[model samples]
Target: MRNNTGPYFIGNNTCMFSCWAPEKQKVTLRIVSPKERDIPMEKDDMGYFHVNVADIPPGAEYYFMLEGEKELLPDPASNFQPHGVHGASAVVNHHTFPWEDAAWKSIPLEDIVLYELHIGTFTEEGTFDAVIPRLDDLISTGINAIEIMPVAQFSGERNWGYDGVFLYAPHVTYGGPEGLKRLVNACHQKGIAVYLDVVYNHVGPEGNVLHRYAPYFTSRYKIPWGDAMNMDDRWADGVRDYISNNPLYWFEYYHIDGLRVDAIHTLYDSSAVSIWELINQKVKSLRETLGRPLYLIAESDLNSPRVTQQPIIGGMGFDAQWLDDFHHALYTLADSRGKRRYEDYGSMHQLAKAYTDGFVLSGEFVKFRKRRFGRSSAGVGGNHFVAFTQNHDQVGNRVKGERLSLLVDFERLKLVAGALFTAPYIPLLFMGEEYAEEAPFLFFCDHQNPELINATREGRKKEFADFRDEGEPADPFDRNTFLQCKLNWLARRQGRHAIMLRWYSELISLRKEHPALRSYNKDNIQAEVIEPGMLVIHRKSKDKNKVMVFLNFAEHDTTYRVPAGNVLWKKLIDSRDARWNTENIASAFLPSEITETNFVTVPAICIAIYTGAQ
Candidate 1:
């Protein structure tokens, strides 16, 4: 508790600064006070150095002085660096930041309608403070949780936040620690839970100095970025503890409600129960200790139910897992979309399967993998899965980074959104998706190394070889590409963008107001594949509240026979109200409401929500 990791009493200060520089000949404390003075450090038996100084306190600027040179070096384990990733570390006083959400409890994963946004691209300013003004938009739109892309310290000022090297530090360019505290506090004030994305698979390629200090990464297995963290080997306890503690730190320190673990499939673990089990165990313990809801959501392609099930039930006990099946299903259904991964989908059957059950590929043949894959979710709870139509991965990883709006018509896009929101699964919307932001979400990283940059470019080029005739694939390392990826706030105020924004707000309202709509029971869901181009989802509630969702994918009017159960039906929402109305929309619905009994007709490419008493 007394910062036992370091040892140091430096010049003119009582604060003891320390760093684990076991490989260095001589280590000094670089304090950015009167000047960048290099204070000599004393070594300990455990290969750590320390220097206690009287002048240093919270907000003091400093970095690990390697070899007595006062170079602008990043701290190997800095918690907050206000300058930059490669600059001096700033001391953050966690106690000093005011948190206003005392009565706040995290919304259950079952009730979470998540909006995943990259902070740098979410707003024009692209900083923590900049996101505060935009909270009303998300809160009003009905998002209960905002899943922020990674905030860890990476090399440059701007990044996707995935290529982070310093695990403990938040990015300086994004307003550092206090700024994040402010943003989280702002989010809590608006009743929106914050879920931070973390990368534990591998450290980013640049400014990674952890290997020089401790045995953080091992040679046992390699990941895309580098050697995976040794989670089941010697000194693995410390590594696990570091990651485990950081989640609670974000919760207890910054008041974040949850964490989205990035890419658990790449985490090489040889332990019997696996590394996921260990982390989920810790998550449960910490959540119990804090007397608040703490969620662990994993981004895994393994399709294993154990990733989200409770440990007591012979499972890992993670709160939720990202359901790629939902994304793929919607992606295929919305646009008849991509040729690359769309080979496995593009039918009403897959979308309907995803609506009723959680996954369509449960022990089924996956043409993408060219094999039978994915286990059945026999014991898995439907609430333990986060489903989405589009995420950063789907759009950003693509060659041109085109959203569904770029590929589909407005009617189909609305239908896709309605299906996702009304489905019996947790829903996530990518940033700018609420308003149908036309900007591309490109894969952009700021790498200092030329070889790394070239490799990234080459990787993108190779990935898009099938699309070579489509046009040139956008370079991933281009600065302009990243800048173009930023969200244009002006979109929300103009044209059909405002209408889409309202539609999202209305959908969120529907999801929150209707308990039947939020039910995660897989078997309780029923869908009628009325035709090849139209599907109707009947969400059955135990409370006797039945809601039927009609989706017409084709560009022509289709007639649907209302079930012969002697039920009186009411139209909840019709997408054609604004566009199809001859005079006023209100007058048009009144006549149809009185006459349309058991026979209802659906307009082309529109989704309508209907509730009835049977």
Candidate 2:
């Protein structure tokens, strides 16, 4: 059946309304504005109700009345919601917006330095237009792409966007569809690609009317958020099409360069062709048809290289997958408390493994899961893995959503950033991470349901029972919590923040300028543990250019002897330099030739980089 879901303008002062509600005996298109009337829709053979209403101009308000019921429900495929989620849907003319990014093209996957930001908390104003003026700052900071958290219409004005219900509409509070298009166009003009984070594993509890309209959810598998999406069950084609078309809609209409699929680990599908494969195939087809680059990045904890492998090779064809093991291993090494998933990490060897190999748990027995987890990602290219020391989940999901700046010392923080940029995988930085902003990224939501709000509060306390002694977690329902997560722009020009920002800029510059540092081939990289808290990494390019990174995690000064080799090396970056507020413990330039007897003194928590001919 041809799926013509949502409102489409058929000209002549008329709009054709169609909805996929197979179970409903009778569906009525109730127009609430420009002459209110209940127009009965005719059901086709495919169980879809559609009707063409005359003189129903653009921006008209309407709803779906199922089974002749008096209670009106929002459209299952609403294109715009002027009011909040509970209110009536608005008719949006998608063709009216003037876009200016005709010459824009997406950045290559290997060249991407992703900066993930939430639209609601990225700036003081917390709106799409507010983010426009800050694009220059991000571009200057060396980020080539910006990944926005979801903006799908949710319950209230304030949310992290994970609780979105109306998949097609941008949140009205965040400037809606027009606001998003403007942001994307502005980003394209500045050579920065925009990636949107989308959640499809489960529908949010509040404002979700999908279950009432169709067989959109399944009860076979239980997810942390709610019931699983019915991707392979009875009458599942419409649901699958609805979910898959969302990415296409964003790419085609919003001109989104890529999509970061959230929590694919929880997306349960038992079918001949998995939902992921179907989505990937559709994305590939779209990219081919458009003759432009469109990427699909998945957030999966499976630690399997096949997640990004091509379907032709018997794997799901994702462009890249988040390498969370790298973050866990690095976080554990930085702070040895072994909190949450950190329990599976914390060893220096694991950090070294993450540097040499993409995944630390490659077919290894996991003590936490009590089972063998992950297959070997041996043949996977480093560019296929997106690595980050801190992201929204790592920071916001915490008891207080404390950033890395609050958890570690300044020196250690610089060292972490240095390690991340020098690694062989694509790097992602959380918003305000470059400047070391002090504001936290707390998990806040504005739910109108009092019962859901109370349940959320109790649920948060129960989840953090292990860390209760750390202090009480901020209430997710509190408006103050949302306000506290906003970025402090003034802090960027202040003392320590300014220095950190400079350090990040310099690191990014180095990464971009050096061929060896830009190489993402894991086989060309080597890592070794010098001691308990000291490590060395060497990256080599195809052109015989090489770069060596030395890290000292110890609390005291230590002399690191050069490995057994005779080579001419030049010092590039020293975290302990006076420019970064650290004591100058090492010389700016090292000896041109280093023998077995050559040794360099490195301060505590310092990172040093040197370049040499391979």
Candidate 3:
């Protein structure tokens, strides 16, 4: 293991050093400079040694001492380490950074169009400050919130940042805690709300030292990784406080707008009272103190109402949940392919159910589970759910890790994109999907253990036994896998990819312009299956604004009749043309461009949007 060696500064010239060295009978702080000096430390009750150095300053280098062994180790809870992950901890003066977003306001989650991106894969440079330049791109796309993947501190130089051990510390490999602060400040200045995805279910399998000094993990319930977080077990109050304080720290110290709770289904708690309520209380308290509307989003498979229901209704106070059923239905229906999770979906009925009830599998027999599963959320508001046609897990967990572009034709991709933007729910897009970038989003980690690495490879093989022959599996720990996932900035300006990017930008613009297209009320939304390969979604607003969306998934044209109504219709937007040109699709129609009985032929795998004339 690498040790930190520094004349480092921590809280002025005098600094404190503490680390858990249970394996060593004796430990010494070896100052390997000028004249080698051995400094002894007093072991605390938690098997950690602590001593304060009187001569160290802000940029000094240092390391730890262990049982006659000399190794430099960084502070286990380092706020900043400019040298390396294994180098001396540097003191970060947080008050020094000049902030210009003092009047920065937060956009409520109810009115947000979120865009989820992994900072490492979002740009070629893959750093916090590097992502600052792309704020204009997101703002132009009409995205109100940016949900970054986990930034928690993890071991090694590169990772997804989920296996973080230091709950309060940002990853040292990615410019540490201060870098994240700068990013958040910059985002606030650009009027973009920053929401970070956090992993509280389980820590990663690396330099996780929390188990040594605190009861952070429990053996009572088994999670995907090692041990489950001790949410409700013995000595858990402190643990819960630690976990809850983490988000508060982010919101208070870092000025983050909200947090996306990762995979809440695995957050097992055998307590009689709801543990979700406890978290909600903590969030409420923090929001009161911060004087801002803080938000929480849960990614759960269970169709339990408690996840999104209001606290006054004896439910958890999460603002929204990730609606995966919508994606699965859209995936199964649009591509006409999917065997695993999509096995129970793809019917126009299921798609209709998803649009009306929020979840298609609500208490229905699902072929994939071989059991009746989920509950219908019929009366819920669409704004209480986040829907996407494709996401990080759907695209990255595949054997080949190819996005929708690899499985289906390009037309189908555009059709799904149209559905995503114009749907009743809040829409989100995965990175690079707007321009149709071909690079795959594969699982890439920087694990040091060889056995763990081999097990990861084998586990992936077993998980995709039925789908393995599609393509070769890329090693998740390989540096090349991470490199390949980076977005090709030039792809947005070349050929068909550029056309796809423009189409996305235009659809988003239209959605923002038309209130009828973006209403979140389920009652205001209606859809009908015209045929096996065609469906139409109609949205009606109180302002007498109404729009109809036609989606054709077959490889041949399908003619759709306008509903029998008392008003004329006018074309609004169509995804058939190379650039969504409304000039022809809007100006000409079979029935003089304004008739209740006009029939229009929707091209193969195309989408058309039309509005009722005022």
**lDDT for every model?**
0.76, 0.86, 0.74
Query: Which one wins on lDDT?
Result: 2
Candidate 3 matches the true fold with a TM-score of: 0.87
C-alpha lDDT (0 to 100) for residue 266 of candidate 1: 85
The 10 consecutive residues of candidate 2 with the worst lDDT sum are 584-593
RMSD of 3: 4.9
lDDT of 1 by residue, 507-554 (tens): 888877776786777777787787768898878677877777888887
lDDT, candidate 2, 1-614, per-residue tens:
12466777665667888988887889998899977999999998777888988887778999999995678899978888998888898887667689888888789989989999999999888899999999999988899899999999989889999999988889998999899999999999999999999998877779888988889988887888767899888888788888887888899889999999998888887777888778888887888877899999999988888898887776778889999998998887776564554778887788888888889998878988899999888678888999998999999888889999998988889999999999988999999999898899998999989999999999999989889887888999889999999999888888889889999999999999898899988899888787768888888898888888887888777677777556667888888777887443442433444445478766778898988853
> Where does the lowest 10-residue lDDT sum fall in candidate 3?
1-10
What does the lDDT read for residue 240 in candidate 3? 62
Find the candidate with the highest TM-score and give its number.
Answer: 2
Give candidate 3's total backbone clashes.
19
